[model samples]
Target: MSLFPTYKRFPLTIVSGSGTTVIDNKGKEYLDFVSGIGVCNLGHRPPHVQKALEEQLHNVWHVSNLYQIPIQNEAAELLTSTTNLDYVFFCNSGAEANEAAIKLARKHTFKEKILTFKQSFHGRTFATMSASGQEKVHQGFGTLLPTFEYLPYNDTKAVQDVQDDQVAAIMVEVIQGEGGVIQGNKEFMEAIEQKCRELGALFIIDEVQTGIGRTGKAFAYQHFGLDPDIITSAKGLGSGFPVGAMIGKEKLAETFSAGTHGSTFGGNPLASAAIKATLEVIFKPDFLQSVMEKGYFFQELLNEKIGSLSVVKEIRGHGLMTGIAIHTEALPVIDELRDHHLLAVPAGPFVVRLLPPLNVSYQEMKRAVEILAEVLDQITDKTINSD
Candidate 1:
């Protein structure tokens, strides 16, 4: 059988990657700003991660979850110690982590409904797909999982107006990575936590794309200083290795005991090794500070380079989770960027998503912006010529 025809795959075929750069089979060099859709926060095949994986390969790889794994414990410790989350349940992807979080919320609260926002994307699983607020994603899927509601994102008044006690959780992305890089309003985000407290509902932050220092913070929720009840994370957690985690406070620990939730390959020795190595690098105080510095530097460069474009609306995001909102189509702009040997992805109809590596140097950041400037010029020229 042939492979299923899915995903409007990009035309480029990558051969190998080093740091923030990749090579196509045609031997063309590209500065990868996609970061594997925010998975390679540390860039591809980082020396430390490669070394860690090699060491684990020489030892044991998979040991199942029947027995305790010290490396898993180490990985868990790194997360718990770093964030307000008291406990962690390892899974295999952002979707699994979100599914686990949903299960825990429903189980713990004994409630049926979840509250999400418009343009929010959790995952592709039945439950997560149902949780997503975008209609396009739910168009083809018949019989989605039940009990979900949507609110306008970053609207404090909408949050304040909530009167539903049936809301098991309020799941939100600090920065809607897939929703055109839409950011959460600080006041609204804070109000969500307060409302959750008043309603006795769980507060869930979907940090699948913003965690693991993608936002120059260990977790993007920390930026708002709101303490969520449950946080789902993946993508960059393992620095390109497949690993996810659902972190929660200690009070709900009893709800997920034993058989309620699990995964056979979630925290295997190999995955744990990848996580530990990634954490060791990004979790360093100096390293995170540097990320913060780099994030500002990148945004500043973009602002100075492309600020005058009429088609461009704005460049906004926290840390490296940046986006360029435009009046015209972003697809052509993204294609133009690719032609210039710079890789970027589209966030929404009018948004060009830019998720550079957290460790991408200021010089590389500047060059990427310069390349973007050239692409914008081409886009403008094309529009003029067509007219």
Candidate 2:
């Protein structure tokens, strides 16, 4: 059978990756700045992640949740302790985590209304896509889940105007990854938290793309001093392996009773092993400090090189999940970077996103910046020549 033609794939097919570089089938090397859409936090095929998966292969791989899984317990312990949350539920992907969070919120509050913000990308599942504020993704997906409302992002009063006891939860992204790397305002987030409290509604933070060490902190919510009632994470949790988790306060988590929700592959031994190793490496003081330092260094380099370009409008985002908004469509820049043997992704129509591996070296970052500078110059020269 032919493979499904869903993705608009890049010209090259990557065969292997190590650290921040990937080699295509033709043996051409490219610096990976997108980090598999921010899933490869520790970079591609880190020794720790590889070793954990290797060791688990020698033992057991799949054991249903019907029985005890020690690795799952270890991962849960680490996640809860690191984030200071009380309970956790493991799933296979970010979409499932968000799905579980949605169900839990509604069940616990016995309310049907969920308030989300504009330009937010949650996940691709039926309910998650419905919850997502991006109309492009929701297009063609039939009638969405009911009682969901969309409001302008960063508007506290808009949220306050609709909040009520019937609201089950307010879901948000601390940093909107697929929505052009826009960071949420601190005041707006705090106000939403306060409103949720006042209305007895849960506040769910979808950190699927910004969690782990991507934001120079364990979780992006920590930066704003706002604690979410429930937090969902996935992309960086397993450092490439598929894993997702929904963590919450002890009382709030109780709503999920036996048979409430489950996944066959969630928290499997292999994925859990990867998650355990990823957390161990990322939670280290030195590693996290390096992430912060590198983020500043990269942003400085970008500002120095392309910040003043006529087509470059703004540079936004924190830590490694950065985006550069250009006056022109970003696809041309993305393609130019590929020609220069650097890989990146477009976050939106005018934003070129950079989500290099958290462990990306200073040297690699410098090389990427140089290449981007060259590409920008070429684009500017071409535009001038045409004019």
Candidate 3:
């Protein structure tokens, strides 16, 4: 069996990685800016994460939720203390975390409808895909879990227009990562909170991509100063290990009794160890502050170097999760950057997304900016000469 044919993968076969760089099968070193789609916050093979996993491997790996796992309790405590949420339901990926959140909202409110915004992406699960505002991902998935309504993002009026008491929850992403890294306006977020309160709907924030310090804040929702009834996190939670969590207020979390939901490998010993180590590192004041500083440095350098290029349109997003909107398609530029030993991913048709490791050094940032500048100059010169 030749692997499942799903992803249109890149040509290089990455064999190993360290810090913010990866080595392909041919041993070519490339700086990794995608961070495994915002999962590897501490970069590849962080010593603490590695040591924790190594130590756990010898002790025990899996023990179903049937038994008591001290690590699980520890992970939950660490996570809850870091955010406003009260409890955590650990799972394996962003989709599972979102699935739990959806279930919690429905169960808590005893309602059916869910309100999401346009250009939002929650996850790939059936319910999440249904809740997602992007049509392309839901295409052919066939009538999804019912009672989901999509409204225009950042439009308070659109949210206000939805008149449905059956609305169970309002799910949002403070920074829409897949939606070209657009951040929801503060007023827009406050408006949603107000509407949720008015309509008695649970407010949910999908922080899978923006959580765990990707947005300079521990959780992107904190930046808006708004409290959400439920929150989902995954990407960087375990720094490379698979771990997702649905966090909710104490009362809301209690809505799901024993059999209502459970995952066999969700909070296994090894995963918990990874989570603990990652949290210890990412939640540090100095580390997060550095991310904020580096993020500013990166945005400034990017704008200074290529912001005026004819092919560039705009730069948007906050902290480390940035998107560059270009006048031309971003795929060619992404591939070209790979040729120059840099890596980036395309967010939308015309936008290149950057989710570099939170600990990326200043020198690395300078190198990345220098390479991007050179590439943009070449592309511009080619276009001019052809004209």
> Could you tell me every candidate's TM-score relative to the true structure?
0.98, 0.98, 0.98
> Looking at model 3, which ten-residue stretch has the lowest summed lDDT?
156-165
Can you write out model 1's per-residue Cα lDDT over 72-185, one digit (the tens) per residue? 999999998888889999999999999999999999999989999999999998999999999988998887777999999989999999998888899999999889898988
- The per-model lDDT (C-alpha) reads 0.92, 0.91, 0.91
If both were scored by lDDT, which would come out higher, candidate 1 or candidate 3?
Answer: 1
Q: Which stretches of candidate 2 lie over 4 Å from their true place?
A: none
Clashes of each: 0, 0, 0
Residue 249 displacement (Å), model 3: 0.4
**Most lDDT-accurate candidate:** 1
Model 2 per-residue lDDT tens digits across residues 1-387: 397986778787899999999999988999999888999998899999999999999999999999999999999998998775898899989999999999999999999999998899888888899899999998886898877888899897887677467889999999988889999898899989988999999989999999998989999999998878899999999989999999999997568888988989999999899999999999887998899999999999999998987778899999888999887889989998998999999998999999999999999999999999899878777777888
Clashing pairs in 2: none
